[model samples]
Target: MQKLQTLFAPSAIAVVGATDREGAVGGAIFQNLQKNFEGKVYPVNPNRDVIFDKECYQDLASAPEVELVVIVVPAKVALQVLEEAGKVNIDNVIVISAGFSEQNDSGEMLEQQLIGIADEYDINLIGPNSLGVISTHSGMNASFGPALPQTGTISFMSQSGAFVTATIDWAIQRNIGFKDIVSLGNKAVVDETDLIKEWGDDPETDVVIGYLEGIDDGREFIDAARDVVMDTPVVLIKSGQTEAGARAAASHTGTMAGSEQAYEAGLRQAGVLRADSAEQLFDYARALAGLPSLDQNTVAVVTNAGGPGVMATDVIGESKLSLATFTEETIDAFDDCLPAGANIYNPVDIIGDAPVDRFVEAIKIALSDRNVGAVLVLGAPTAVLSYADLAEEMGALAESHDKPIMGCLMGGKEADAATKILDKHGIPNYFDPARAITGLEGLARLNTIRSREYHSFEPFDDVNSDRVEQILSDAVADGRSRLGVESMGILEAYGIPTPEGEIATSPSEAKEIAEQYENSVVMKIVSPDIVHKSDMGGVDVGVKQRDVEDAYERIVTNARRYQPDATILGVQVQQQVDLSETTELIIGTKYDSQFGQLVLAGLGGIFVEIFEDTAVRVGPVTDREAATMLSELRAYPLLRGARGRPAADEQSIIEIIQRLSQLVEDFPAIMELDINPVVARPNDAVAIDLRLTIDEGKL
Candidate 1:
């Protein structure tokens, strides 16, 4: 990652279309840079003598030692300027020119030509239609935008120049500082992932942020963002999540936006901090940057009102954070400094009338407790003592005790004073307890994920590559890319377990197998054409000895009626195991345009689409990560025995997912796999239905 600052900064900069004409983009850009930038400026205009107190040059050849050039000229002339800039070894160019790529094919061709020229000289480019890039640390302002704030630690990268300028203005108003901001219009060459990777390692940048229209390479974005996440915190405000947004994103950045479900799964797998809105992106970035890595998700709340404490509890619970129950020792310490009627449990009610010392003692007790990883102090202003003094003492205790502390003050003017005092001490404080708790939840969730990752799983090597190749090859020969139950069953025997079933060519064989297995069994008409057995009524469950004879006929008749064009391959008879728990899980591969085969895992069944509960780990997820993913599901409580029923063997599900992940990782030809209704019987689980898709082109 060459230093990103160079792309926007130069000792001597050239503005190719700089003019004296009022309200022109070129004129605005020249004025903005002249106002804020401290670097040498050269305004390039064929007709003008001078602009912004700098001598105007006729072309790139006339600008002496131009290190970075901003092009606001027409698209046709922009290409020529890039070509000339390349010849002169001007290695950094910011194209504010709009007629490339965002307009039509003609513009796209022009943008490509500019890229080719830059590539010939190994020069870096920012955009063909951009507000340009800015670096506050270097005093470089190439964007034709308002002045940006210089306080917080954030970096914003976007595919739209308009959003970049709007975000800069918003940040400036809120006193939010930026390290680096880039507008990657069209993304013809430079992409979101490229900048994320570069910004993550940039010394001036603390928290990397983005406003993404769409990812050009979904897989590359995942890989690069995952690598960056290992070091810097990344928050993305992904805009193209809906159907309408997807179409707009494709037109805006020339990217085929993926399904919303898949995009979210990928984000979770990469462990990137996700935000639904730009405000959240900024808030989360601000809060997370100052917070320490929490040891646990348990938080203690000390509030002057019960209402606020209840609200905080609700938020914490909703976010999967726990409210700590103070130990007997902790309660005794709090009682010593409080009135007799004060509540001393997890959410301690210090009462509204409590003075500064009382609030301080309660906070001290909460922070000192062994079980508490963090404390939320909710103080209302009191006339008897100074709120600022109380806030100072709380901050002092937080610093000395080595525990994260946050506050929510209730009174209007006094609360602001107290909150500012906490901020001055570098404590992460919010005006509302619920918001503070939400931030705490962020800390808690991250800690849980980190804890789960500590125990890694070993890789398994039980896959039969030769069998996979043969099955995939045969499927492709017949214009079919998906494998039937029989083929999937064969693959399953090699560590991927399927139901105890046997394929039979004749009714006699089906009956014999049914009798051999149990009094109760299932008879399913098998055919490569019918992937979903239940959809075709090809499955007959609870087959007794007498019913086996009839159930076989019923399945065969149903198969022929449902799929008239297909041949009845046979029936599969298997024992019907009592499934105490009914849950579905899917493990499959999608041929991503950029990333090749990517594995996916999620809750299955018809409700799977409704619940949309899923998580991804790149192919070959460790067993530990699989288990954590399963546990992380929103509906995990149901699998953990929500009622009186015994819990499913959670470890078994993780093992299956891990094995399938390894299979997909080893065999690129296996395009998709579905394990619906993996019946869990307290101690064991079995894949009752299976289907596979293969891609011969990949093989």
Candidate 2:
């Protein structure tokens, strides 16, 4: 906080490369500072003796020492200026120059050099290619953008310079104010996590909004966001929702973690509200900033027209919120206030020609209901009542109630005037009922997040870490990064149930193993190089004792033909368990480059391959989170005994997921682990096949 205080609220500032040329970036920044900033501003440029009718110093040596410096020179000259500023004891900088990491190879080199210089001198740098920073509370507009916004509680941070300029323009036109604004260009030094922490402690900020192209460290960002959301809401709009967008994000921000699924899972885990578009970002922010946090998900609607009231009710039903049921006492109150023939249900329609007193009475009755968590008032244009009078009454009622109250005055000219009245009283007004309902939905989501409990992963003492370590160590020693059928011992060490199996080097050994089992047996080729054993024809199921030797030979032949260079150890012979009555499920874990370990589960076999129905959560997942992950999957109904089939062993599946999460948390080198076709019956679950991929680099 101390470091950032100087960057955002410095006592004095110096603008290197300052100019008076019209339409120039440096000139624009200087002009903005001169107009709004309530501090000393020094213009440093060797070419100019005077800038903006103020004395301009030729260099840093001639200028007075300042706490912050804005560098708008070329990349080559910015480095020299940084060294000079360091000598003059300037510890804060915002480099507005382009041609940094955002450019080609030479620019990347220059950025690295800038990082090294900042580290050596203990300087806090904002950007080498940035749009700059602004603080409305301090009357500081240090950017090369437009004028400062109106003072308000929302603070915005963006990774794109153009987005910052556009959002500022948009906010000004909409009368949306901000406490602070930042453009995190390149993010070489100050990243999103830093700003989250800073603004989380800032008393002036009621909400923190962000536009992120990519995240550098997923776990760190999640932790930071989690802490901030505990005190203030954090609304974010993340790009890269598609594969093409992911690729573009990587190229744009130089970030490696471009997986949109990972970002979504991580943000949800951190309790951050994600907006699909720029407008929704502020839409959520405004509601969060203006209204009290909703404690429940039920909303009550009061309307003058039935159509808009029904529309609001439908949208609420579609959202995660439910319409509130009116209590008997509340129903009696509404019936007494409203005229005859008025509908007194969840929508609480008071008829079209209702007067101001009738509208006020309906809202007051709805707000007084204990079952109603929030209130939505919808009004259509009517000749009997004025929209402004109803808006004023609703705004006063909103201010008096602790619950969130939103309004939808469905019209243009008169509604616009009414909206301004509501806005002045800090009551969010929407033009449509759906928009008002969506805003209430945002409040409900925040309530859920606030009430959620985050549990830590507790290590089970029964896990045999030594046994699992030996298996991974031996595989690495043999120059094999992947563990094949022989690695079932690792699963057994973690207490995950697996079918009894034995490695047979020859056909005689395979037949001998099959003779031990009364029912049919299964044979699979054991090799490190083959990932998808079925694709290579390396598996044979339902092999009787008479055909065991042939099955073993055929599996080996098929594997060798598919990959001649693969080192096939032997055939894995095991008792074939009937899965016709059981659910085929897949449980796996992979180390994501950004978010560390992630656990995935879904229906196995062709359903998993074609439908791609899976649920993901970051490790080390709690028991509750594991169950929640399963419930999120589209195939969860199948596991819950759909179609009169007995329910699969849900507890067993959750325990396996918990154990897998623990395994990955303990041994990060176990990069990718898959257990496909885990036959789950009524009371038991067992893994039929296991594959483990280890990254020796981590080891």
Candidate 1 lDDT (Cα, 0 to 1):
0.73
List ranges where model 2 is wrong by over 4 Å. Answer: 1-3, 245-258, 560-567, 578-581
Per-residue lDDT tens digits for candidate 1, residues 251-329, read 1001221355456756666667778877667767766666566787788998878888888888878776788878899
Alpha-carbon TM-score of each model against the true structure: 0.83, 0.93
- Could you give candidate 2's per-residue lDDT for residues 477-509 as a string of tens digits? 999887778899998999999988899999999
Scanning candidate 1 in windows of ten residues, the lowest lDDT window is: 248-257
Model 1: what TM-score?
0.83
lDDT of each: 0.73, 0.86
